[model samples]
Target chain A: MNLFQYVRPAEQKTAIAAVAAEPTARFLGGGTNLLDLMKRHIMQPEKLVDVTRLPLKGITQQGNIIRIGALTRNTEIAEDKTILQNLPLLAMAINAGASAQIRNMATTGGNLLQRTRCPYFYDTAMPCNKREPGTGCGALEGFNRMHAIFGFSDKCIAVNPSDMNVALRALDATVVVNGPKGERKIPIADFHRLPGDTPEKDTNLDKNELITAVTIPISPFSKNAYYLKVRDRNSYAFALVSVAAALNMDGNTIKEARLAMGGVAHKPWRLTDAETFLKSKTATEENFQQAAQIAFQGAKAFKHNQYKLKLGPNTIVQALSVASGLKSV
Target chain B: MNEQEPFCPNESRRSFLKKSTVITAVALTPAAAINAANNHWDEHIAAAIENVSLSVEINGTRHTMDIDPRTSLLDLLRENLHLTGTKKGCDYGQCGACTVHVNGERVLSCLTLAATTDGSKVTTIEGLANGDELHPMQAAFIKHDGFQCGYCTPGQIMSAVACIREGHASSRDQIREYMSGNICRCGAYPNIVDAIEEVQKGGQKV
Candidate 1:
């Protein structure tokens, strides 16, 4: 890594200004992704504004909403009593993603902003529009085994690698951020952006804007929530097709449902249509299969990831089956 | 820029005299320090220009070093202070060979910036034992043969200790799940889980 300026600002605004002052500067969180990116020569920041000193590490609940500070470590959030009790889907998803050591170091805010695991994006030698625009996407034609099955453009076939994000989208969480302009709340769905023509932009968050916290309204699906991840391995691997399925059940009928899938799109692929279809329907394997089919209506698969076309529905049905208590976990 | 705390350097096993003299020279006079650091003048100068003051208590000894802000805690242990027991398997978070306890929580040292650990307490594999006496987890690893080639042993031990402490070692499957971060390329996972289970079952403080 090249030599660069590093500043540890104590306050949130000071940290924001330090990053805003230098266009090439970036905010340093847990440094799990940023440091690795820098070492790989994929990202080169002239200055790093360290925000670890900022007092933004806590989980607070107000009435029905729970607010998690930006710097709260993944392990902290996963193991918190209230989170496991109320938002167990988030806990299950976070725990399912990485190992315990990584979860200990990774922060909640940093997890949301993690880049794609697409091999092309990590390999600078490859032509990746996400790395450098107009470079041409190597994954689009090259071995796209881990590429997207939805929300992909002709320019990029990468997928967001965060399992935490998939659960957050299902819970309808809101991301609170502070920038030079002011503070604003972005719903989790809007927080991450699809790699449209501009594959370089991963999120709707502007430059120098710091994520302060994430708030989630008390969920109704806590009793019947499940995060099912299918990966190359049973443990310590990214999901090939993961589902965060939650249901509000009235006996055997589904009062409501929130569903999202990971490793299939540039963002957490929220199955709004599937969720809409499952409402008032009986919670059964046949209904889940139908919902799963509806969720993948617009999903487009690549050459190597055609297995996802089959794996995707299986994962969705499995998640919904377990979450609805039609089948055991 | 503040009072440097010294937590009893009277019994340092790694020649605290020479290290403290070098630290004093570096903090007081750059000319003498540069001469002392002649081998790494390039990194020293660059890091000196944007020096971030970091004071960390490692294994009971306090060290305040000027580091390149990008210097990871793994690099700090292996390079700066010569405490190389903590292995750097992947140099990234993927492999947990750089596992260390930061304020009693196990974290990947390779992913942790030295500057970010300024006021924190760090414990590496080198610090697990009390002088010559091994920790309970270490003894259990020996009894159960938890490693082969021993490259990933240090990180596995650190993470194992943490797994038990975090109450994640309740079952064999849970131990494997929690310790998945520390990958043993030699495939000593079954024995590793046995060792952790023994330590947990023995009810020994790690």
Candidate 2:
């Protein structure tokens, strides 16, 4: 790690100003990913503006929406009574992502902005277009078992490694960002960008913008939602092909549905087609299987990750079954 | 100003002043120096070690010291404060060997920067015991034989204490899931779970 100046801005204005003034400055949330990347010499921010102290730690419900402050820790979000009752899918997805220790240290904003867990990005010796644009992508031709199978660019095949983002995308959440200009709300679907030619830019957030909160609208999928993750280990591992399924059922028929997948693409891969297909359909194994097939319409797999073609659908079917009460949790 | 007496034996006074000016500029403000370094200012490497004042309370004892901003909480505890019980396994967040409590929440000390923890309270493995008396979690670990090589026991016990307190220890599966952060190469997971279960069942305050 390199020696850098540390600034803890108590006010949001101060924090935003500090980040805007310095091109090499980064906002420190939980410091789980940023610090790890710093120790690996992957990112060398000249100054770390610690925003943990900013007044953005609230988790409240305003009528039909649940607003989660950007600095709220993952553990708190997972165990909060309101979230557990209203957004159980988000709680489950967050709980399934990391261990308790990490959950304690990781904030909602930090989790959403977390970089890829691609090995090539971690190892500076290797070439990663995301880590260093024009360096060439090592995972495209190298050991890419964890690489993406959807929305992959020729420059990068890395997957977004956040379970919480997938749930947020499915919930149709909105990200509240504060910047030099003012505040703006970005729909969660457009928050994270696919690895196009510019894989360096993870989210749609501008350099001067700082995430303040995330708001999710009240929905009927509260009671019937599941976050199913299949990993190498049962816990404390990134998802290989995780599914976040939520169904608003009209008795036996699906009134509405939301589906998103992790470990599949550069961003949270929302299954808009699958979600549309699931509406008005009977919540059964066959319908879920058909929806899963629709979800993988344009999914292109790498050499080592071809198994995701099978596992992805299976996980989706299982998640749908669990969420719809067809299968036991 | 002293042209006759050179600061260095071989260097000229004018060159020495130029070098000293650069060093002084870097020492006074590191952001400019970092910018210079980013632009390949290799000569100012000596002035890059920026020191920051940190006031932290550890194990109920408060210490105010100047530390390099790059120093991790784990390194500060083990190297600076001599609290070595908090082991460093992977030196990254992957291994829980550096697990410690920050404001009563278990966090990987290795990933936590000392500068970021200013005015915060931390509890390490060394602080588990109350003078002569062992914490219930520590005693339970001993009674249940929760470790073999004992390298990862400190982190396991710390995490177990947190897991129980956080209400994640209601069942064996939950304990396993919560304590998954601490990896035991010796495979003493069953015994570790037993320790946590006994402590949770005993109703002793952790």
**TM-score for each prediction?**
0.92, 0.93
Model 2 CA lDDT for position A147: 85
Taken over the whole model, the C-alpha lDDT of each candidate is: 0.86, 0.88
Per-residue lDDT value at A113 in model 2? 93
> Per-residue lDDT of A1-329 in model 2, one digit per residue for the tens?
76566766667898899888878889988899999899888898888887887778879999999999999999999999999999999999999988889999999999999986599999899999888899999998899899899999999998999999999999999999999999999999889998889999899999889999999998999989999999999999999999999999889889999999999999999999999999999989999999999999888888899999999999999999999999998
- Candidate with the greatest TM-score versus the true structure: 2
> Which residue pairs show collisions in model 1?
none
Candidate 2 chain B worst ten-residue window by lDDT: B1-10
TM-score of chain B of each: 0.78, 0.82
Position A129, candidate 1: lDDT: 94
Name the 10 consecutive residues with the lowest summed lDDT in model 2 chain A: A1-10
Residue A273 of model 2: what lDDT? 97
Task: Kindly give the stretch of ten consecutive residues in candidate 1 chain A with the minimal lDDT sum.
Answer: A2-11
Candidate 2 off by > 4 Å: B1-29, B35-49
For candidate 1, what is the lDDT? Answer: 0.86
For model 1, how does the per-residue alpha-carbon lDDT over B58-107 read when each residue is reduced to its tens digit?
99899987676778899999999999999989997888899999999998
